[model samples]
Target: MKMSEAFATTIAGVAPVILLVAAVEIGNRKEALREGYHLIGQRQRLIDELYAAPEAPTGLQLQAVAAQTDQPMQSATRDLFIALYVMSALIVGVLLLLAESLALVWLAGSQRGSHPLQAAFCLLALVIGFAWVMLAPMLGLVVAVADDAVVVISGVSRLRRFYRDLDTHDRQQQAADGEQT
Candidate 1:
Protein backbone atom coordinates (compact mmCIF):
# COMPACT_ATOMS: atom_id res chain seq x y z
CA MET A 1 0.00 0.00 0.00
CA LYS A 2 1.05 3.60 -0.43
CA MET A 3 2.56 5.14 2.69
CA SER A 4 -0.27 7.66 3.04
CA GLU A 5 -2.87 4.93 2.79
CA ALA A 6 -1.11 2.88 5.43
CA PHE A 7 -0.58 5.86 7.69
CA ALA A 8 -4.19 6.95 7.31
CA THR A 9 -5.37 3.52 8.29
CA THR A 10 -3.14 3.62 11.34
CA ILE A 11 -4.55 6.99 12.34
CA ALA A 12 -8.10 5.78 11.85
CA GLY A 13 -7.63 2.70 13.99
CA VAL A 14 -5.88 4.63 16.76
CA ALA A 15 -7.71 7.94 17.02
CA PRO A 16 -11.44 7.46 16.51
CA VAL A 17 -11.67 3.89 17.76
CA ILE A 18 -9.74 4.50 20.97
CA LEU A 19 -11.41 7.82 21.74
CA LEU A 20 -14.89 6.33 21.29
CA VAL A 21 -14.23 3.32 23.45
CA ALA A 22 -12.49 5.23 26.22
CA ALA A 23 -15.23 7.84 26.51
CA VAL A 24 -17.96 5.20 26.77
CA GLU A 25 -16.10 3.12 29.34
CA ILE A 26 -15.15 6.13 31.45
CA GLY A 27 -18.74 7.35 31.51
CA ASN A 28 -20.00 3.91 32.51
CA ARG A 29 -17.47 3.60 35.31
CA LYS A 30 -18.25 7.06 36.63
CA GLU A 31 -22.00 6.36 36.71
CA ALA A 32 -21.54 2.99 38.37
CA LEU A 33 -19.29 4.47 41.08
CA ARG A 34 -21.78 7.24 41.74
CA GLU A 35 -24.52 4.69 42.28
CA GLY A 36 -22.28 2.62 44.54
CA TYR A 37 -21.49 5.64 46.74
CA HIS A 38 -25.19 6.38 46.97
CA LEU A 39 -25.81 2.87 48.20
CA ILE A 40 -23.10 3.26 50.82
CA GLY A 41 -24.70 6.46 52.08
CA GLN A 42 -28.12 4.79 52.34
CA ARG A 43 -26.60 1.91 54.28
CA GLN A 44 -25.19 4.37 56.80
CA ARG A 45 -28.62 6.00 57.20
CA LEU A 46 -30.22 2.60 57.75
CA ILE A 47 -27.73 1.79 60.52
CA ASP A 48 -28.39 5.14 62.16
CA GLU A 49 -32.15 4.50 62.19
CA LEU A 50 -31.59 1.02 63.63
CA TYR A 51 -29.52 2.45 66.47
CA ALA A 52 -32.12 5.16 67.15
CA ALA A 53 -35.06 2.73 67.31
CA PRO A 54 -33.63 -0.78 68.02
CA GLU A 55 -37.00 -2.25 67.07
CA ALA A 56 -39.25 -3.03 64.04
CA PRO A 57 -36.32 -4.41 61.96
CA THR A 58 -36.27 -8.20 61.38
CA GLY A 59 -33.35 -10.37 62.58
CA LEU A 60 -32.52 -11.42 58.98
CA GLN A 61 -32.46 -7.76 57.88
CA LEU A 62 -30.07 -6.87 60.70
CA GLN A 63 -27.91 -9.82 59.87
CA ALA A 64 -27.76 -8.73 56.22
CA VAL A 65 -26.64 -5.26 57.28
CA ALA A 66 -23.99 -6.76 59.54
CA ALA A 67 -22.69 -8.96 56.75
CA GLN A 68 -22.17 -5.95 54.48
CA THR A 69 -20.81 -3.65 57.19
CA ASP A 70 -17.22 -4.79 56.82
CA GLN A 71 -17.17 -5.25 53.05
CA PRO A 72 -14.22 -3.54 51.42
CA MET A 73 -15.04 -0.58 49.23
CA GLN A 74 -12.91 -0.36 46.16
CA SER A 75 -13.12 2.94 44.36
CA ALA A 76 -10.89 5.27 42.39
CA THR A 77 -10.80 9.01 42.02
CA ARG A 78 -12.03 10.53 38.76
CA ASP A 79 -8.50 11.39 37.70
CA LEU A 80 -7.32 7.87 38.39
CA PHE A 81 -10.19 6.25 36.50
CA ILE A 82 -9.83 8.59 33.53
CA ALA A 83 -6.12 7.96 33.40
CA LEU A 84 -6.65 4.21 33.48
CA TYR A 85 -9.30 4.34 30.79
CA VAL A 86 -7.13 6.45 28.46
CA MET A 87 -4.11 4.24 29.03
CA SER A 88 -6.09 1.09 28.34
CA ALA A 89 -7.49 2.61 25.17
CA LEU A 90 -4.00 3.57 23.99
CA ILE A 91 -2.70 0.06 24.48
CA VAL A 92 -5.53 -1.37 22.43
CA GLY A 93 -5.03 1.28 19.76
CA VAL A 94 -1.35 0.46 19.46
CA LEU A 95 -2.16 -3.18 18.92
CA LEU A 96 -4.79 -2.26 16.39
CA LEU A 97 -2.35 0.01 14.55
CA LEU A 98 0.09 -2.86 14.25
CA ALA A 99 -2.57 -5.19 12.93
CA GLU A 100 -3.93 -2.68 10.42
CA SER A 101 -0.48 -1.75 9.13
CA LEU A 102 0.53 -5.37 8.73
CA ALA A 103 -2.67 -6.08 6.85
CA LEU A 104 -2.00 -3.09 4.60
CA VAL A 105 1.49 -4.34 3.83
CA TRP A 106 0.23 -7.82 3.06
CA LEU A 107 -2.44 -6.41 0.78
CA ALA A 108 0.04 -4.12 -0.98
CA GLY A 109 1.21 -7.21 -2.88
CA SER A 110 4.83 -8.26 -2.98
CA GLN A 111 7.11 -7.19 -5.78
CA ARG A 112 10.19 -8.97 -7.08
CA GLY A 113 13.35 -7.54 -5.48
CA SER A 114 11.50 -5.97 -2.60
CA HIS A 115 14.12 -4.84 -0.09
CA PRO A 116 15.23 -7.00 2.78
CA LEU A 117 14.93 -3.92 4.98
CA GLN A 118 11.21 -3.55 4.22
CA ALA A 119 10.34 -4.77 7.70
CA ALA A 120 12.62 -2.16 9.18
CA PHE A 121 10.89 0.47 7.10
CA CYS A 122 7.55 -0.70 8.39
CA LEU A 123 8.75 -0.39 11.99
CA LEU A 124 9.89 3.20 11.52
CA ALA A 125 6.72 4.02 9.66
CA LEU A 126 4.68 2.78 12.59
CA VAL A 127 6.57 4.98 15.04
CA ILE A 128 5.94 8.08 12.98
CA GLY A 129 2.36 7.14 12.29
CA PHE A 130 1.72 6.61 15.98
CA ALA A 131 3.23 9.97 16.86
CA TRP A 132 1.10 11.66 14.29
CA VAL A 133 -2.01 9.88 15.45
CA MET A 134 -1.51 10.95 19.04
CA LEU A 135 -0.43 14.51 18.40
CA ALA A 136 -2.31 15.48 15.28
CA PRO A 137 -5.20 17.23 16.97
CA MET A 138 -2.86 19.28 19.12
CA LEU A 139 -0.45 19.97 16.26
CA GLY A 140 -2.96 21.37 13.76
CA LEU A 141 -3.86 20.08 10.32
CA VAL A 142 -0.89 21.46 8.39
CA VAL A 143 1.72 20.14 10.79
CA ALA A 144 -0.05 16.82 10.98
CA VAL A 145 -0.05 16.52 7.22
CA ALA A 146 3.69 17.15 7.13
CA ASP A 147 4.16 14.57 9.84
CA ASP A 148 2.12 12.11 7.85
CA ALA A 149 4.06 12.92 4.67
CA VAL A 150 7.32 12.10 6.41
CA VAL A 151 6.43 8.44 6.55
CA VAL A 152 5.89 8.26 2.83
CA ILE A 153 8.99 10.30 2.06
CA SER A 154 11.16 8.10 4.20
CA GLY A 155 9.84 5.01 2.47
CA VAL A 156 10.87 6.45 -0.88
CA SER A 157 14.40 7.12 0.38
CA ARG A 158 14.56 3.57 1.74
CA LEU A 159 13.59 2.18 -1.64
CA ARG A 160 16.27 4.21 -3.33
CA ARG A 161 18.92 3.05 -0.85
CA PHE A 162 17.89 -0.57 -1.29
CA TYR A 163 18.23 -0.36 -5.07
CA ARG A 164 21.55 1.44 -4.76
CA ASP A 165 22.84 -1.37 -2.54
CA LEU A 166 21.64 -3.97 -5.04
CA ASP A 167 23.41 -2.11 -7.84
CA THR A 168 26.67 -2.07 -5.89
CA HIS A 169 26.40 -5.78 -5.13
CA ASP A 170 25.76 -6.57 -8.82
CA ARG A 171 28.82 -4.59 -9.90
CA GLN A 172 31.01 -6.33 -7.35
CA GLN A 173 29.81 -9.69 -8.56
CA GLN A 174 30.58 -8.76 -12.15
CA ALA A 175 34.09 -7.60 -11.23
CA ALA A 176 34.75 -10.84 -9.35
CA ASP A 177 33.58 -12.89 -12.37
CA GLY A 178 35.89 -10.89 -14.67
CA GLU A 179 38.85 -11.57 -12.37
CA GLN A 180 38.07 -15.31 -12.49
CA THR A 181 37.80 -15.20 -16.27
Candidate 2:
Protein backbone atom coordinates (compact mmCIF):
# COMPACT_ATOMS: atom_id res chain seq x y z
CA MET A 1 0.00 0.00 0.00
CA LYS A 2 1.09 3.57 -0.66
CA MET A 3 2.06 5.83 2.26
CA SER A 4 -0.96 8.06 1.58
CA GLU A 5 -3.33 5.10 1.80
CA ALA A 6 -1.69 3.86 4.98
CA PHE A 7 -1.93 7.28 6.62
CA ALA A 8 -5.57 7.69 5.69
CA THR A 9 -6.33 4.21 7.03
CA THR A 10 -4.62 4.98 10.33
CA ILE A 11 -6.55 8.23 10.79
CA ALA A 12 -9.83 6.50 9.99
CA GLY A 13 -9.07 3.74 12.48
CA VAL A 14 -8.16 6.16 15.29
CA ALA A 15 -11.18 8.40 14.77
CA PRO A 16 -13.59 5.77 16.11
CA VAL A 17 -11.54 5.28 19.24
CA ILE A 18 -11.50 9.04 19.82
CA LEU A 19 -15.26 9.21 19.41
CA LEU A 20 -15.84 6.26 21.76
CA VAL A 21 -13.59 7.64 24.49
CA ALA A 22 -15.28 11.03 24.27
CA ALA A 23 -18.69 9.42 24.66
CA VAL A 24 -17.63 7.41 27.68
CA GLU A 25 -16.04 10.40 29.33
CA ILE A 26 -19.17 12.45 28.80
CA GLY A 27 -21.32 9.72 30.36
CA ASN A 28 -19.05 9.41 33.36
CA ARG A 29 -19.10 13.17 33.89
CA LYS A 30 -22.89 13.24 33.70
CA GLU A 31 -23.21 10.50 36.32
CA ALA A 32 -20.74 12.25 38.59
CA LEU A 33 -22.65 15.52 38.30
CA ARG A 34 -25.86 13.74 39.25
CA GLU A 35 -24.26 12.19 42.31
CA GLY A 36 -22.69 15.47 43.30
CA TYR A 37 -26.03 17.23 43.10
CA HIS A 38 -27.57 14.55 45.30
CA LEU A 39 -24.84 15.07 47.87
CA ILE A 40 -25.44 18.81 47.74
CA GLY A 41 -29.05 18.19 48.58
CA GLN A 42 -28.06 16.02 51.53
CA ARG A 43 -25.73 18.70 52.80
CA GLN A 44 -28.51 21.27 52.57
CA ARG A 45 -30.77 19.03 54.57
CA LEU A 46 -28.13 18.65 57.27
CA ILE A 47 -27.72 22.40 57.41
CA ASP A 48 -31.44 22.83 57.75
CA GLU A 49 -31.53 20.40 60.65
CA LEU A 50 -28.74 22.24 62.39
CA TYR A 51 -30.52 25.56 61.97
CA ALA A 52 -33.93 24.35 63.13
CA ALA A 53 -32.89 23.99 66.76
CA PRO A 54 -30.94 26.29 69.09
CA GLU A 55 -28.82 23.53 70.57
CA ALA A 56 -25.37 23.17 69.07
CA PRO A 57 -24.31 19.85 67.69
CA THR A 58 -21.16 18.13 68.96
CA GLY A 59 -17.91 18.13 66.98
CA LEU A 60 -18.31 14.44 66.28
CA GLN A 61 -21.78 14.99 64.87
CA LEU A 62 -20.54 17.72 62.54
CA GLN A 63 -17.64 15.56 61.43
CA ALA A 64 -19.95 12.65 60.77
CA VAL A 65 -22.25 14.82 58.71
CA ALA A 66 -19.35 16.16 56.71
CA ALA A 67 -18.07 12.71 56.08
CA GLN A 68 -21.45 11.55 54.92
CA THR A 69 -22.19 14.42 52.58
CA ASP A 70 -19.21 16.67 51.87
CA GLN A 71 -16.76 13.89 51.13
CA PRO A 72 -18.86 12.41 48.37
CA MET A 73 -19.46 15.79 46.81
CA GLN A 74 -15.77 16.53 46.81
CA SER A 75 -14.88 13.14 45.41
CA ALA A 76 -17.42 13.24 42.63
CA THR A 77 -16.46 16.74 41.62
CA ARG A 78 -12.79 15.92 41.57
CA ASP A 79 -13.27 12.72 39.60
CA LEU A 80 -15.51 14.33 37.04
CA PHE A 81 -13.24 17.33 36.58
CA ILE A 82 -10.16 15.17 36.11
CA ALA A 83 -11.96 12.93 33.67
CA LEU A 84 -13.04 15.95 31.64
CA TYR A 85 -9.50 17.26 31.51
CA VAL A 86 -8.15 13.92 30.39
CA MET A 87 -10.79 13.69 27.72
CA SER A 88 -9.86 17.10 26.39
CA ALA A 89 -6.20 16.16 26.29
CA LEU A 90 -6.97 12.97 24.44
CA ILE A 91 -9.03 14.82 21.87
CA VAL A 92 -6.24 17.29 21.31
CA GLY A 93 -3.75 14.47 20.87
CA VAL A 94 -6.00 12.70 18.41
CA LEU A 95 -6.47 15.86 16.39
CA LEU A 96 -2.74 16.38 16.16
CA LEU A 97 -2.19 12.80 15.07
CA LEU A 98 -4.83 13.09 12.40
CA ALA A 99 -3.27 16.29 11.12
CA GLU A 100 0.12 14.64 10.82
CA SER A 101 -1.36 11.67 9.08
CA LEU A 102 -3.18 13.83 6.58
CA ALA A 103 -0.05 15.79 5.87
CA LEU A 104 1.80 12.58 5.15
CA VAL A 105 -0.98 11.36 2.92
CA TRP A 106 -1.04 14.60 0.99
CA LEU A 107 2.69 14.55 0.37
CA ALA A 108 2.65 10.97 -0.73
CA GLY A 109 -0.29 11.43 -3.01
CA SER A 110 1.19 14.53 -4.61
CA GLN A 111 4.38 12.63 -5.44
CA ARG A 112 2.40 9.75 -6.99
CA GLY A 113 0.14 11.87 -9.23
CA SER A 114 0.93 13.62 -12.51
CA HIS A 115 -2.27 15.65 -12.81
CA PRO A 116 -2.24 19.15 -11.28
CA LEU A 117 -5.85 18.85 -10.21
CA GLN A 118 -5.15 15.66 -8.25
CA ALA A 119 -2.19 17.28 -6.51
CA ALA A 120 -4.34 20.31 -5.63
CA PHE A 121 -6.97 18.09 -4.06
CA CYS A 122 -4.41 16.41 -1.83
CA LEU A 123 -2.95 19.77 -0.81
CA LEU A 124 -6.39 21.12 0.03
CA ALA A 125 -7.09 18.14 2.26
CA LEU A 126 -3.77 18.64 4.00
CA VAL A 127 -4.52 22.32 4.71
CA ILE A 128 -7.98 21.59 6.04
CA GLY A 129 -6.74 18.82 8.29
CA PHE A 130 -3.98 21.01 9.69
CA ALA A 131 -6.33 23.91 10.34
CA TRP A 132 -8.83 21.70 12.14
CA VAL A 133 -6.15 20.16 14.35
CA MET A 134 -4.78 23.56 15.26
CA LEU A 135 -8.21 25.00 16.06
CA ALA A 136 -9.86 22.17 17.94
CA PRO A 137 -7.61 22.34 20.99
CA MET A 138 -7.98 26.08 21.33
CA LEU A 139 -11.72 25.68 21.51
CA GLY A 140 -11.58 22.60 23.72
CA LEU A 141 -9.18 24.17 26.20
CA VAL A 142 -11.37 27.23 26.66
CA VAL A 143 -14.40 25.09 27.40
CA ALA A 144 -12.59 22.69 29.73
CA VAL A 145 -10.93 25.42 31.74
CA ALA A 146 -14.18 27.33 32.11
CA ASP A 147 -15.95 24.25 33.39
CA ASP A 148 -13.19 23.45 35.88
CA ALA A 149 -13.21 26.99 37.21
CA VAL A 150 -16.94 26.91 37.84
CA VAL A 151 -16.75 23.63 39.72
CA VAL A 152 -13.87 24.82 41.87
CA ILE A 153 -15.62 28.03 42.76
CA SER A 154 -18.83 26.28 43.75
CA GLY A 155 -16.99 23.68 45.82
CA VAL A 156 -15.13 26.38 47.70
CA SER A 157 -18.34 28.25 48.41
CA ARG A 158 -20.01 25.15 49.83
CA LEU A 159 -17.06 24.44 52.10
CA ARG A 160 -17.03 28.02 53.35
CA ARG A 161 -20.72 27.82 54.22
CA PHE A 162 -20.26 24.56 56.09
CA TYR A 163 -17.39 25.92 58.17
CA ARG A 164 -19.20 29.15 58.86
CA ASP A 165 -22.14 27.28 60.25
CA LEU A 166 -19.89 25.25 62.51
CA ASP A 167 -18.26 28.41 63.81
CA THR A 168 -21.59 30.04 64.57
CA HIS A 169 -22.71 27.01 66.57
CA ASP A 170 -19.51 26.98 68.58
CA ARG A 171 -19.89 30.67 69.49
CA GLN A 172 -23.48 30.13 70.60
CA GLN A 173 -22.43 27.31 72.85
CA GLN A 174 -19.73 29.47 74.43
CA ALA A 175 -22.22 32.22 75.13
CA ALA A 176 -24.68 29.81 76.70
CA ASP A 177 -22.01 28.34 79.00
CA GLY A 178 -21.06 31.81 80.23
CA GLU A 179 -24.70 32.60 81.03
CA GLN A 180 -24.99 29.36 83.00
CA THR A 181 -21.89 30.17 85.08
Candidate 3:
Protein backbone atom coordinates (compact mmCIF):
# COMPACT_ATOMS: atom_id res chain seq x y z
CA MET A 1 0.00 0.00 0.00
CA LYS A 2 1.27 3.44 -0.87
CA MET A 3 1.31 5.32 2.40
CA SER A 4 -0.07 8.76 1.90
CA GLU A 5 2.22 11.68 2.65
CA ALA A 6 -0.97 13.04 4.21
CA PHE A 7 0.53 11.92 7.52
CA ALA A 8 -1.02 9.07 9.48
CA THR A 9 -1.08 8.51 13.25
CA THR A 10 -0.09 4.92 13.87
CA ILE A 11 1.49 2.77 16.65
CA ALA A 12 0.05 5.05 19.32
CA GLY A 13 0.67 8.32 17.51
CA VAL A 14 4.07 6.94 16.45
CA ALA A 15 3.26 7.53 12.80
CA PRO A 16 3.44 11.26 13.22
CA VAL A 17 6.66 10.78 15.15
CA ILE A 18 7.84 8.50 12.42
CA LEU A 19 6.85 11.11 9.91
CA LEU A 20 8.74 13.73 11.90
CA VAL A 21 11.74 11.50 12.13
CA ALA A 22 11.38 10.66 8.47
CA ALA A 23 11.20 14.32 7.52
CA VAL A 24 14.35 15.04 9.50
CA GLU A 25 16.03 12.05 7.94
CA ILE A 26 15.03 13.22 4.50
CA GLY A 27 16.29 16.73 5.17
CA ASN A 28 19.59 15.38 6.41
CA ARG A 29 19.82 13.23 3.32
CA LYS A 30 18.99 16.17 1.10
CA GLU A 31 21.84 18.05 2.74
CA ALA A 32 24.13 15.16 1.92
CA LEU A 33 22.91 15.26 -1.67
CA ARG A 34 23.65 18.96 -1.75
CA GLU A 35 27.15 18.27 -0.56
CA GLY A 36 27.53 15.54 -3.14
CA TYR A 37 26.36 17.82 -5.91
CA HIS A 38 28.68 20.50 -4.59
CA LEU A 39 31.54 18.05 -4.60
CA ILE A 40 30.66 17.00 -8.14
CA GLY A 41 30.55 20.59 -9.39
CA GLN A 42 33.38 22.22 -7.45
CA ARG A 43 36.22 20.76 -9.44
CA GLN A 44 34.43 20.56 -12.77
CA ARG A 45 36.76 22.94 -14.58
CA LEU A 46 39.78 21.24 -13.09
CA ILE A 47 38.25 17.89 -13.92
CA ASP A 48 37.69 19.01 -17.48
CA GLU A 49 41.27 20.15 -17.58
CA LEU A 50 42.24 16.83 -16.11
CA TYR A 51 40.04 15.04 -18.62
CA ALA A 52 42.03 16.70 -21.35
CA ALA A 53 45.44 16.08 -19.77
CA PRO A 54 47.82 13.24 -20.59
CA GLU A 55 47.83 9.91 -18.85
CA ALA A 56 49.79 10.13 -15.60
CA PRO A 57 53.30 8.79 -15.96
CA THR A 58 53.73 5.40 -14.34
CA GLY A 59 56.39 3.48 -12.36
CA LEU A 60 59.87 4.93 -11.85
CA GLN A 61 59.48 7.70 -14.44
CA LEU A 62 56.39 8.78 -12.56
CA GLN A 63 58.29 9.01 -9.30
CA ALA A 64 61.24 10.69 -10.97
CA VAL A 65 59.10 13.31 -12.68
CA ALA A 66 57.01 13.89 -9.59
CA ALA A 67 60.13 14.40 -7.47
CA GLN A 68 61.57 16.84 -9.97
CA THR A 69 60.03 19.95 -8.46
CA ASP A 70 63.25 21.89 -9.04
CA GLN A 71 63.90 20.37 -12.48
CA PRO A 72 62.95 21.88 -15.84
CA MET A 73 59.57 21.03 -17.38
CA GLN A 74 59.45 17.82 -19.41
CA SER A 75 55.72 17.45 -20.12
CA ALA A 76 53.52 20.07 -21.74
CA THR A 77 50.03 21.27 -20.75
CA ARG A 78 48.75 18.70 -23.22
CA ASP A 79 50.41 16.10 -21.05
CA LEU A 80 48.58 17.33 -17.93
CA PHE A 81 45.21 17.01 -19.64
CA ILE A 82 45.96 13.46 -20.68
CA ALA A 83 47.22 12.55 -17.24
CA LEU A 84 44.21 14.18 -15.61
CA TYR A 85 41.75 12.26 -17.71
CA VAL A 86 43.44 8.99 -16.93
CA MET A 87 43.64 9.76 -13.23
CA SER A 88 40.01 10.86 -13.22
CA ALA A 89 39.03 7.61 -14.87
CA LEU A 90 40.73 5.75 -12.06
CA ILE A 91 37.70 6.66 -9.92
CA VAL A 92 35.22 5.91 -12.68
CA GLY A 93 34.29 2.64 -11.05
CA VAL A 94 33.27 4.39 -7.86
CA LEU A 95 30.92 6.71 -9.72
CA LEU A 96 29.56 3.74 -11.65
CA LEU A 97 28.79 2.04 -8.37
CA LEU A 98 26.91 5.13 -7.22
CA ALA A 99 24.84 5.26 -10.39
CA GLU A 100 24.02 1.56 -10.22
CA SER A 101 23.02 1.75 -6.58
CA LEU A 102 20.74 4.70 -7.25
CA ALA A 103 19.08 3.00 -10.18
CA LEU A 104 18.58 -0.21 -8.22
CA VAL A 105 17.08 1.57 -5.24
CA TRP A 106 14.79 3.58 -7.46
CA LEU A 107 13.64 0.49 -9.33
CA ALA A 108 13.15 -1.56 -6.19
CA GLY A 109 11.11 1.16 -4.54
CA SER A 110 8.91 1.47 -7.61
CA GLN A 111 8.00 -2.22 -7.44
CA ARG A 112 4.57 -2.98 -6.02
CA GLY A 113 5.02 -3.36 -2.28
CA SER A 114 8.25 -5.28 -2.57
CA HIS A 115 10.37 -5.98 0.51
CA PRO A 116 13.78 -4.64 -0.36
CA LEU A 117 15.31 -5.06 3.03
CA GLN A 118 16.42 -8.65 3.27
CA ALA A 119 18.86 -8.39 6.11
CA ALA A 120 17.74 -9.65 9.56
CA PHE A 121 17.59 -7.29 12.57
CA CYS A 122 18.01 -4.13 10.59
CA LEU A 123 18.74 -0.95 12.43
CA LEU A 124 15.85 1.43 13.16
CA ALA A 125 13.48 -1.53 12.92
CA LEU A 126 10.22 -0.92 11.02
CA VAL A 127 9.00 2.66 10.97
CA ILE A 128 12.27 4.37 10.22
CA GLY A 129 13.13 1.78 7.65
CA PHE A 130 9.80 2.32 6.00
CA ALA A 131 10.48 6.03 5.94
CA TRP A 132 13.88 5.35 4.42
CA VAL A 133 12.60 3.51 1.38
CA MET A 134 13.80 6.42 -0.74
CA LEU A 135 16.83 7.22 1.34
CA ALA A 136 18.47 3.82 1.00
CA PRO A 137 21.15 5.28 -1.20
CA MET A 138 22.03 8.36 0.84
CA LEU A 139 24.30 6.95 3.51
CA GLY A 140 25.98 4.62 1.10
CA LEU A 141 26.61 7.32 -1.50
CA VAL A 142 28.04 9.73 1.05
CA VAL A 143 30.29 7.00 2.34
CA ALA A 144 31.41 5.98 -1.13
CA VAL A 145 31.91 9.51 -2.35
CA ALA A 146 33.79 10.60 0.75
CA ASP A 147 36.15 7.66 0.81
CA ASP A 148 37.20 7.87 -2.85
CA ALA A 149 37.43 11.66 -3.01
CA VAL A 150 40.41 11.92 -0.70
CA VAL A 151 42.90 9.88 -2.71
CA VAL A 152 41.73 11.36 -6.00
CA ILE A 153 41.88 14.92 -4.72
CA SER A 154 45.31 14.47 -3.21
CA GLY A 155 46.67 12.83 -6.33
CA VAL A 156 45.31 15.55 -8.57
CA SER A 157 46.55 18.28 -6.28
CA ARG A 158 50.03 16.84 -6.47
CA LEU A 159 49.85 16.63 -10.25
CA ARG A 160 48.63 20.21 -10.49
CA ARG A 161 51.37 21.46 -8.21
CA PHE A 162 53.92 19.54 -10.20
CA TYR A 163 52.61 21.02 -13.43
CA ARG A 164 52.88 24.58 -12.13
CA ASP A 165 56.36 24.10 -10.72
CA LEU A 166 57.75 22.64 -13.93
CA ASP A 167 56.02 25.20 -16.11
CA THR A 168 57.57 27.96 -14.02
CA HIS A 169 60.96 26.31 -14.20
CA ASP A 170 60.78 26.08 -18.01
CA ARG A 171 59.81 29.77 -18.32
CA GLN A 172 62.68 30.87 -16.06
CA GLN A 173 65.12 28.66 -17.97
CA GLN A 174 63.96 30.16 -21.26
CA ALA A 175 64.45 33.71 -19.94
CA ALA A 176 67.90 32.84 -18.58
CA ASP A 177 68.87 31.20 -21.86
CA GLY A 178 67.70 34.27 -23.79
CA GLU A 179 69.74 36.56 -21.44
CA GLN A 180 72.92 34.43 -21.70
CA THR A 181 72.78 34.47 -25.51
TM-score for each candidate, following the candidate numbering: 0.28, 0.36, 0.29
Candidate 3 CA-lDDT value? 0.43
- For 80-152, candidate 1 gives per-residue lDDT tens digits of 4434444655665565556455546654655433333544455454555455445533333344355557667
lDDT of 3 by residue, 141-174 (tens): 5545555676579789999999999999999999
Steric collisions counted per model: 0, 0, 12
Better of 2 and 3 by lDDT: 2
On lDDT, the leading prediction is 2
For model 3, the stretches where C-alpha displacement exceeds 4 angstroms are: 1-126
- Candidate 1: residue 44 Cα off by (Å): 2.9
lDDT of 1: 0.55
**What pairs collide in candidate 2?**
none
RMSD of each: 30.1, 11.5, 16.1
For model 2, the local distance difference test gives 0.60
- Each model's C-alpha lDDT? 0.55, 0.60, 0.43
Per-residue CA lDDT of model 2 for 41-134, tens digit only, reads 7788987886677888878878887777756554564545555555664655555455545545555554643434433443444444444445
lDDT of 1 at 111: 45
Best of the two (1, 2) by TM-score = 2
